[model samples]
Target: MISYNIFTLTNGLRVIHIPNNSDVAYCGFAVDAGTRDESENQEGMAHFVEHMIFKGTEKRHAWHILNRMERVGGELNAYTNKEETVVYSSFLKEDFERAAELLTDIVFHSTFPQQEIEKEVEVILDEIQSYKDDPSELIFDDFEELLFPSHPLGKNILGKPELLRKFKSNNAKEFTSKLYRTTNMIFFVQGNIDIKKVKRVIGKLTNDIPLLPTYKIRCKPLPYLPIKKILSKETHQAHIMIGSRGYDAYNDKRTGLYLLNNMLGGPGMNSRLNVSLREKRGLVYNVEANLTSYTDTGVFCIYFGCDIHDIDRCISITEKELKKLRDNKLSSSQLDAAKKQIIGQIGVASDNFENNALDISKSFLHYNKVEQPESIFKRIELLNSETLLDVANEMFSEDYLSTLIYK
Candidate 1:
């Protein structure tokens, strides 16, 4: 079992630390602000600000910020999602203070220079174009837009080019000043450093963070009507996505659905979808199921790319598999095997220290505490066939599912 420490700073920023004997350390900031937090006018401002953050700080130029950790054989990176943004680093344990201090400087004191905004916007625009060229990846964004309709949750994290060109430094500053707050951020560290030293270092660096009032409110998406969409595109293969909104982060049924997704189309080659589409019938090269849950909503989707001629057959087989899960409970042995498989997967994943730190940070961000591996294993162990059956019936029924295909 991995042990961790959690504490709150005087300014309301929360911190979590995991101690280990490794020479390398991982640390970062996970903020509760993301694409969904943006106003319609600010379509991709969250992600835009994330890029600009590295461009410069009040005291450091883009070059200085980029090299701060690298010069010492370390790395810095950041990413934005639907409901969260993370800026983190991995470096030698001796450079823990350097990493923490640099994270604070960029996240809190970014200058968002006008020249950087212009350059980064072009880069982001090119990125948007690259996605357009890959129908398989672009289909997922189109699917979500179809799933949520007019909601902000449906907006692509990469905003439209017309809007992207109009973004200025003021836009980034406005977005950050409004959403980035001490109360909405969590600082996380993982290394062999002493807990007291971690707290003291973070406390001094973050002491200037104002305890701003919370003004952010995430409105849950309204009920969605299922729709089937087939868009014509110039591609040799058909990329399809079939999914429905699943449980939120706080829902109890999420655990069962997670288990069900793993069995259906997880990363393992033996997953049902992989075996059916790739091994048994030789229909496609890749098939996988994904579940992405937010604070108040979630997305459960299955994606596959296949020869255009095989589209109908693949959909038929997919539906057949869903029906079987809804109609019959897993046998006692099957359930036991699934529980063991997922438990073992979780154990393997926990061994990745970088991902483990980020995972625990997210857990703490949502629940105000980190759940141990044993706790998660217990949840999986408690899942019975009835629970899985019910989850399948509720979430995987044909009526609740929506289909999006790129042909």
Candidate 2:
């Protein structure tokens, strides 16, 4: 079992410390600001601002910041998602203080130099082009575009190149100042250190975050209506993705969906979709399903790539497999197999302490507490075939799923 302690700063930055026997520590800030927080005028601003954050800070130049942990053979990295921005690092256990101080500097005090912002805009624009060049990957974004047609949730994180080019330093500063509040952040660390010491370090590092009068409030958008779209592309193979809006992270149905998705098409080779679509019929080379849950909504999708000539047959077979899950209740033996398989998969994945820290931080952000592995397994075991079929009935209903195809 993983044990952790929590601490809060005077302003509101929550800190989590998980002690481990490992020599390397994983620590950083998990900011609550992301793409969905951007306004219409700032389509790509969240992601753009994420890139500029490392450009420079009030105390440390970009180069110095880059080498702060690297000099000690550690790494500093960050990423932007639809709902959060994470700047984290993996460093030697003794360098925990150094890592915390540097991360605090970047997240709270980035100076966003003018020249750096300008250059990064061109780089991000290039990124947008690279994504468009791959139809299989691009189709997922296009699918969400159709699903959440008028909402920020639908906007690609790599915003429009034209809009990105016009973003100035102050623009990023304004977004950061308004959204990156002490009240909206979490400091999570895992290492071979005393819990009290970790708390003290985080408290001191975040002692200066300003206390804003109001919190950033993002209203949940209306649920998406199902829609199908076709994009004609000059590509070597046809790609298809179909899915419906799924239960949010907070919903009870989410656990069932997690198991159902894996049985249908998870990382393992024996997944129903992989076995039926590739092993037996040999319709396509790549086929998989993914489930993503956010604070207020989720997107579940199945993507497959095949020769254009085999597209119709693939879709037919895919629907047949989904129909089995939706209409047929699993036998007791089948349910037990799936439950044990997923439990083992989760167990194997939990061995990575770095990923464990990241997941724990995100869980705290959402549920305000981290659930132990045993509790999670209990919930998974309690779910019956009826629960899974019920979820499949809703998530796999033809009326709810949308299709986006690139051919």
Best by lDDT: 1
143-206: candidate 1 lDDT, tens digit per residue: 9999899898999999878888898888888889887888888999999899999989999998
Evaluate all candidate structures by whole-model CA lDDT and list the values in order.
0.92, 0.88
Local accuracy of candidate 2 as per-residue lDDT tens digits, 158-246: 99977887889899999998888877778899989888778778878877776664357777868678888878897899999989888
List pairs with backbone clashes in candidate 2: none
Off by over 4 Å in 1: none
Compute the lDDT for candidate 2.
Answer: 0.88
Worst 10 residues of 2 by lDDT: 208-217
Q: How high is each candidate's TM-score?
A: 0.98, 0.98
Give the C-alpha lDDT of model 1: 0.92
Number of colliding residue pairs in each model: 0, 0
